[model samples]
Target: MGNRTAVIVACALVGLTVSTPAFADSPAPSTYGRASYLLDESTGKAMISKRADKRVPIASLTKIMTAYVVLGQAKLTDKVRITAKDVRYAERGGATTADLRPGDRLTVKELLYGLMLPSGADAAHALARTYGPGVDGFTAKMNATAKAMGLSNTSYVNADGLPARGGDGYSTARDQARLAAAALRNPTFRSVTSTKSRTVASTADHRAYSWTNTNRMLDAPGSLGVKTGYTRAAGFNLAFAADRKGRRLVGVILGETDSSRRFDTARSLLKWAAKHPVEGNG
Candidate 1:
């Protein structure tokens, strides 16, 4: 073919290939639950959502706020000597513990590991007690922190998120997402939750105990560290994140029937989000 004819032929072939459409992108799926929201961290877009603003008990997911308070107020190197009070709080309400004892000592960083990994109510109280003038004072800090973070629907009664005297602790899916996003801002907070396993030194005897993360999403493919919650009142709740195909997404599922399905539903939601980008839903 002449040079001009050959160039025209090549251009026509390129146009034909470019004009043909590639496979259509899959659609994101809907899910069941009273309230939920999935957000793309990059674009501030909600991919899926259902009643995300309705207030509900958040269970231990409240610790995301607790983590923010402690990390913000205390320094890692500050020494926390476990008190009789600390031991009492740690052993309170039959919650899982790092077995802290009276007079045992660790840095603030170490206590945070116990606080987040096992959702230890005791460690949370201890940090609050030491950092605040008293427990009530610490709770005031938690509430104040919530307001500062624009969590209009959040209120905290205790540092550990164990059941309260009058009733359940309250927060909305949107409020919890705000807490999770705030927690993500601190490099230290990210370090604590993302960890699958950690060894916490017993304050009383200096023995080390291994505590595993309760959020099963950590085991899920592409799962990142966040938080988990459960109680008879809260059912099963979770806030999670994952990076797939260079797009990072955050998901929150509350009121799931059981622990396993909470993880399953979260995995399903994330998968759907990856395939389908829906604004103002999550």
Candidate 2:
């Protein structure tokens, strides 16, 4: 119940923990990203923070919020009609798409897979235009959701985190972890994110739209659903989660150096957190 004991307990849960300093109260860990944060999902306790407050590009991890807003505003069974403008916008942006095309009618549930799994931008565009009035309106709703969440270091320039003609999206690691925590609370969001592979039947013509999760961290034990992200500016950003026994933890890393490093860093952090096993955090 001492403050010193509480700090030590919290750090262990974050993983990549710092040893108790011989002369100082706190010290930073070297084995982390340019910005990183880890949280105990069950309790909302911050387990780790390294430059977690600095804002930076978040890439496809922005989809977590995109999916969040979509699920809140639309029914999963509602069918949405894709437009030529939606397909063209996504393709022209060089975004990783789900191969969705104009005339493809898919349910909001299917589109959720398109957004979370494979990190599809076309899916994001379709959902935004259909559910959001338009992409701008959806993005505005995303910002409003961030505001309601009290996220000071978060903003959405686009639904899929792709660069617009003007700018790309950005958020801090801490803010991102907070976003992931809120998102994972949704059973639907959690279920979709954790799914490794799925085939959705298009409402257009019953064509199977198969997709896979982009989060390699799922290969790790106790892995839960979250999201992945990348851009030249954001590097290999990732928002990941894992559950061990009953303990759940969320990890957010931005500006990682490469693809392999992104998953490796997350795996190591979560594994360490699992082995360390913060008390009462379970």
- Give the least accurate 10-residue stretch of model 1, judged by summed lDDT: 14-23
lDDT of 1 at 155: 88
Residue range 4-74, candidate 2, lDDT tens digits: 66666665554434422311243333344578887776766666676778888888988889999988878
Q: List the residue pairs that clash in candidate 1.
A: 38-282, 47-282, 48-281, 48-282, 49-281, 90-122, 104-203
- Residue 25's lDDT within candidate 2 is 44
* TM value for model 2: 0.87
**lDDT of model 2 at position 150:** 94
- Tens digits of per-residue lDDT for model 1 on 1-282? 655455445434432111111213332344445577777765676665557778888888888888888888788989988778766765667666666777878898988888888887778878888877677898899999888878898888888778888776788877787677667868898888889999866756757878889888887666777988888888888889887766667777788776787777788878766765433422
Report the lDDT of model 1 for residue 223. 70
Scored by Cα lDDT, where does model 2 land? 0.80
